[model samples]
Target chain A: MYDEPYRWIEAVANRRQYLDDQFIHGSPLVGISCAQGVLLLTFNRGTEKIYEIYDRIALGGMGHPADLEKLRFTLLDMAHVEGFQRSPSDVTASRLLKNGLAPVIKPAFEEIMRAPYIVKILLVELGTSQDRDHLFTMDYDGMFAEQREFGVLSASSSSGDRLSAEWKSFGVVASLSSALEIGLRLWGVASLLQDSSTSPEVKIEEKDKPSSTSPSETPEEAEVTTRIREMLANETLECVLLDRESGKMETYRSLGQSDLQPLIPTEFQPAT
Target chain B: MGQQGDFLQVLGEQGYDVERVFSSHKVDALHASGMVTTGTTVLAMKYRDGVLVAGDRRATAGNVVMYDRTDKVLELDRYSILAIAGVPATAFEMARILEHSFKYYRRSQLQDLSFEGKLRALSTLLKNNAPAALSGTGTVVPIFAGYDLHDTCGKIFFYDILGAEFEAVEYAVSGSGSSTIRGIMFYLNRWSQRTMVELDEEEALTLVLRLMTSAAEFDSATGGIDTQAQLYPIVKGISAEGVRSIPVERLSQLFSEKVVNHV
Candidate 1:
């Protein structure tokens, strides 16, 4: 008996961009945009052997259910019923739109053209949030921009423009310390403008604050705490800082109260 | 007498006369007819790492300094060296003959002659010339130093005019000025821990020059360092790395520095 359910689970796990398990297999695709914004098309030999079109704008943030469903049907239809094989010629934007699937995919496309916020949110979620280096930002009408440094996707064209301009002005950082500072400041500004709950704040302790008199504690420990406070106050961003030495990245949240000493080099004796 | 009878002449006919001089205890007979020359001073001292072999560079014919630039020290082979004294030419010839003999033996046997073997060879060569020495023709005394790879340390061999060989424990000296040189070196020996690591190339050279200077001052046969020629005492260091003669320029610099500070 054919194990349809198990095969379907494996396909879903493999087809998705990310996989936690090492045993799963996945196919590679080169998603490019020429005329009709940027579109992602999957080519899998085991499953559907056809170019399935995905609207960049429509699937920006949280993808539209109707758009995803129509894409799924198109893929299945090409694989099973029509048995439409994808040659090199079938990969173009004109060929995809000329196919029968375009009519069903048009509504979600219009929605993305009206709202660019979905794209920005999707990019911020997938691009900056992931440990890997893969981010795609497609335009409203369908133009693609591959970002080498940082990518911004948004419904509001002006907001995306502002973020890109600001990021470009900062330029490439030579050291990790400088990158962290710049990234945090940009994220902080973005959070403030978006009115998000992730805004960072500096905490100042008064001179009269009660000090613990533990006999076991050394003076060096107290000095370290003070130095950490100074670094937190000086930090201008709300972005994650990656520890190059330990190869670990964490959210740049002061309230999380994680140890940051590992990120600081031993050569640095933080000044009061 | 016929021509053959001329060859069989008496000691007086050959201008050979035996004279008596006081030894340490009593009178001893020594030849006095021929040219009187002070015997050379040669010494070999066993140190922790290796042996130090030195010689005074003074060749005298009676009261006149015949040769002031004599190099009495010689490297016999990889492991051993010879330092000569007595008649300069005779001593040098003996050194050369022994060096050749050692080379010949090493080539034939495909192995190096040991320190003791080298001493025996030198004594054999000297024994062949005993008749000439008794007739006041010439005499040579040499000190041999070598690093015994089997023993893992340095060894020194001292010889007398009669070709009698003796192995010294720590230090040995031969030559007319050896007593004075030995006296200075004895004090230095006490300070040095018989370890080869204790004395480096610089310290060894310094010690040798100091001893040489003291010997030159007291002994008429021991000549002073040639400052005009920029020639200092010839110093060679032998270690596991092999024998290397110190550069004359470096020795001259060291000698000048020592001389300038002497007020």
Candidate 2:
């Protein structure tokens, strides 16, 4: 069904590298701020999508996956120390995600300084009531914006077109399964799959050549998308939830392929 | 003074005493009114799980006991504690500067400074104050102790007025009463050699308390524990669990049972 050679992704990968041209770069991160906690879900592109959470915070980030990994550990260390000195309540989601970004980013922006890479960080607070929880998107430039309901940040498209468009349809009362479903779909191999409802007449070949209306979807997009879905399907979907009952960050999760299989669309076919 | 003069250029424009303040080891108006005074005992020892650091609460002006509630022991991080025995202002300022610097490091690096790194930094601070140390008017000699995660044991570091750093195995003590307390610790170290690993928190705390009490017994400058003022030597432990102080209630108990009752 696919003309180009598909790059296979490993179920357990530590790093990811991206191609320069029009690519459905890495997977986009989708976050939904809930009434009790916030859910941040992203597809595993080539590198391992870093999902880190402790007591009252969960963070997921994209960009130079290596730099993202560094940023992740730094944030966790800062939050842990802050939680230790002050009450755990002092570690707010936005403060950790926003205020904490500068020190890591500024050093790279030294004398002849330029931001090293683009990194989008999503954070959610689990200790507060879901409404009080904060959802934030921070860029490498160290600018962050709070999102009330839902937000999706894509790396492939310059403006993250697909992600921004999909949030309107992502309901506020959407269940956890649907949040992950929408995320897997947007970053899924089927991203190039023509919406089954629209143009059932358009062949899979036309889907390869994305319409001009959509920002440059990766030209070799189908194979990329297919590999992303297959790689994601075999691995467990990582998640961090604040168990409303326990009032604690839920770190241990076993989200097997069986659990998320429903999110995989039938029309989606791996480009083997 | 030339408006465009560089620092050295400006010093030349002024007199030579200006240069003396800049490069020479001479304490002058740069120091506070009461900077180089000393007279207290602070000692630390390695135990089973961590190192115990402590300092007597007395502040002295020569032979006069000026204050009885000073806290000479400062916690640098979760894993390190510093006890100072020097000029009151200089000691407190050094501790304050260190604390602020560590907070900056923690906030920026997103991690605590390493034990060795902390020692180097303190050395740098003391090195900056070499003139005061040489003048003997604003000197600071400190004993730093902390848990070394890499070595899996408690360790101690000592500093001189010139900011020379030395790592001590087993135990270290500093201050006017150091000569007396060192003798006590050396004797205790020989007795405890039979089962060094068996030394626990209680034993470490009691040892530090005994050192401080005995130091004050003969030294008029180092005051003993004052229950009337609710002042006792400040004792802290640094381990994998991080730096924490022994509770005052427990300190009071140790003071009454070990020092007060024995006396």
Candidate 3:
């Protein structure tokens, strides 16, 4: 039996590349978006392997690939072993957050530093179970979070640091939508910085803009227009925000097309 | 005597008549009802994620509606639902009794009974009523549905008058309006592959109501949605969150939107 088991392990290792190839070719990204923000998560249950693409909510590294499977096991344990009669929804985010389990998976900030891609994470403790609780986020690495509101993760280390400093300047926004707007603004700025460093055209677009004020617009409108133009120039790097109030997660290609359009000047139209 | 025996005795004392109706006999009975005092339609279909149970609000006593506010559909638990047809009064009475018993059991035990347990209990109640129903009084038939968490998908069960149950793999329909509803469902089957998240609860309820409305329009025994009275067909969902009734306002909005689009 032992010899057979060893051979089985070797066979699996040898065929691992083929399995991975099959998964990579078969799986596709599934995303959800609405008025608030957008979330993109990948599913590859067929092979029992999982990976995290982008996460800013800080609930530990996108959790293990087997986390969901383990959660299902926990649910079965609760129902069968522990005799806890409760709906699966009752065992989720808001409940975990209320029980203060959000911080259990501490921010492994060092792991994030080694990653090639920038990371951002938001975590809300939903509730606790006798055995486990839940941590929900808008984006976890590449895993999609579908709850109405509670937490968000924004990308860009330098921009994130700057936004954290400026966050204190803005008054407390208790609503999820407001928090998402702030996060989107921070993400937009970070994306711009990232694009300017990698692309020559964005740098030229910034340099060509006139430093002097336009003659007709008010100061606020002019500022809004400039910001919109800057965002539009880096439209490929979109900013997503989650509005918990409406249960909508929306993605904005440029600030001009965002809900803040009323603040932008009429002359500054987003390029479709 | 035990409570079960007492229950059976009471059922026998009541002048209820129940008899097994095969598929051929059911069709004959449908013809005999003069198409007026027809059975209401009850339908349950299993989708990829969960079960969809539906029923029209119309109950006829000869040619007229016995009640407009009738809800012939019920969610028995988070993962289980039931739809009733046959004699309106008898079916409603049976439903209320079963609901009360389930609630009492839950409250007493401080835990929910399993889906199979619930079904077994219902079967017992129907079997006990066999003596009275064998006479000529009335009978109740129901279609039960649930999401078996262990199974990780939806399941549906249909019952005969004698309480003999059969599990339907895809779809099951019963009652006076069943043929029409089934006709509409057969056409909609092509799109049933879509995930539950892709279709909001509001949209799902509208689809059910549309099928019901279409059935009512063609079948004299089935009633169309009463917009003037603000009464709509009953729709419920059983998922990981438990059983929840769809809001009437949402149903009304969808109905209006569909009507506008059609016109």
Q: What DockQ do you compute for every candidate structure?
A: 0.00, 0.02, 0.03
Query: Which candidate tops DockQ?
Result: 3
In candidate 1, what are the lDDT values of residues A1-272, reduced to their tens digit?
Answer: 12477764564444322211111222111121211122222212323211212211112221333333344334223322121123222333233323533444333333422321111111211122223333444432234444545543322232444455555676655554444333333333332222211112211221233363322221233343443344355542122222223211111112112333443334333455
Tell me how large the interface RMSD of candidate 2 is: 18.1
Locate the minimum summed-lDDT window of 10 residues in model 3 chain B: B1-10
Q: What value of lDDT does candidate 3 attain over all alpha carbons? A: 0.48
Candidates 2 and 3, the one with greater DockQ: 3
Tens digit per residue, CA lDDT, model 1, B1-263: 11121111222233322221101211123324225556566666544456667666677776677777778888866667888777665666566556545543443233566666776777776766665555555666778777777777777778777778888887778788888877766766666565333666666666667777777788888876787967567666666755666788887877777654545
Better of 1 and 2 by lDDT: 2
TM-scores vs. true structure, each candidate: 0.41, 0.57, 0.42
Q: What would the per-residue lDDT of candidate 2 be over residues B1-263, giving only the tens digit for each residue?
A: 22221222322433423223323345554444443356888888887877788888888775556778888888866677889988777777667556645543543343456767778778877887787677666678999887777777788999878989998878888888888888877777787564433577776677678788889887777878878778788888887877878888998998788766876
Model 3 chain A weakest lDDT span, ten residues long? A49-58
Query: Considering every candidate listed, which one attains the maximal TM-score?
Result: 2
